[model samples]
Target: MTSVWVGERVRLRAKEPDDWEAFHSFEEDSDAVRNGWRLHPPSSAAYAKKRTAEEAEQRPDLDDPDLVIATRDGNVPVGSIGAHHSDRDHGTFAYGISVGTPYHRKGYASEAIVLLLRYMFFERRFQKAEAWVYSSNDASLALHRRLGFVEEGRRRRSHYANGRYDDEVLFGMTIEEFTALHT
Candidate 1:
């Protein structure tokens, strides 16, 4: 598949050597990590340098593609959305929006997710797509529901984060379901 994709308000491309700064900024946002799960906290400057090298050595995910989506005015990356796979035809996706430190309430995540789903179902030929949202994440739950993903199951008390074992909501949408809805 091509490394670059564009949507109405955003673009998905390959992660480039020049995106080290943006990648570092994303890694440093503790609030962003807190809402979602992040395996590690990264220092901005060091991560930027390391990310450039990492991109060279690793395969691209939906978000990590040499991709950037801007407002068409300034061409800045507001956030990221992409997938990673353990094997062919099965992959998990991560998506979010972070224009600045204070731009959380905006609808970037929704827009990005809509486009990501379209790409996954139509372009990637994925049979199904799955998303795991922290149980307390009402906004995420609502968003997935709106996008036609069914709440298939949950892993109760599955994660021990922030001093609690929170449940994880499992949501999935098959390509057939998505196609039928759109048609």
Candidate 2:
């Protein structure tokens, strides 16, 4: 049977200990880091390897650990995606995705997101999914819209990056809406 985590061009898989180099490469993209929730100093190779080991150790117990986004044909790691701020009581959740600098605009992010949404809404019984995007990140903003997520709200000047503040745009989609569009 086809896997739920498998998509057209990308597949979401458990992060492996050997995936440290790909994770570390993502950190090197200054724009990606700045557009993300927080900006931090550069990560060393040792730190990345350590983090990968920790994630691998934690994966079995976690319902939705950060997953590696890899090319379907060769299984080459390109990025990562993860669910966050999950509220099982309310059937709501949020997620974040990051594609490496070299892999941008290749449709890998889109397919990975669809796979995650399908798993969350269908298998996990989440009613709604939300994503927070920085205003500075135009690509992400467009991607959410293209995927049929509605703009629910925005927090004004809530995120600081690149010597300035950017609004955090909140986008949401319900299970019904996802079914309508993706099914």
Which candidate leads the pack in TM-score? Answer: 2
Over 4 Å off, model 2:
61-63
Tens-place lDDT digits, model 2, residues 53-145: 888877342445578899999999998899988898999999999889899999999999999999899888899999999998999999999
Lowest lDDT sum, 10 consecutive residues, model 1, at: 63-72
- TM-score per model over all chains: 0.74, 0.95
Question: What are the lDDT scores of the predictions, listed in order?
Answer: 0.61, 0.89
The count of backbone overlaps in candidate 2 is: 0
Which residue pairs of candidate 2 clash?
none
TM-score between candidate 1 and the true structure: 0.74
- Model 2: weakest 10-residue lDDT segment is 57-66
Pairs in steric clash, model 1: 13-66, 13-67, 14-65, 14-66, 14-67, 15-65, 15-66, 62-82, 62-83, 63-82
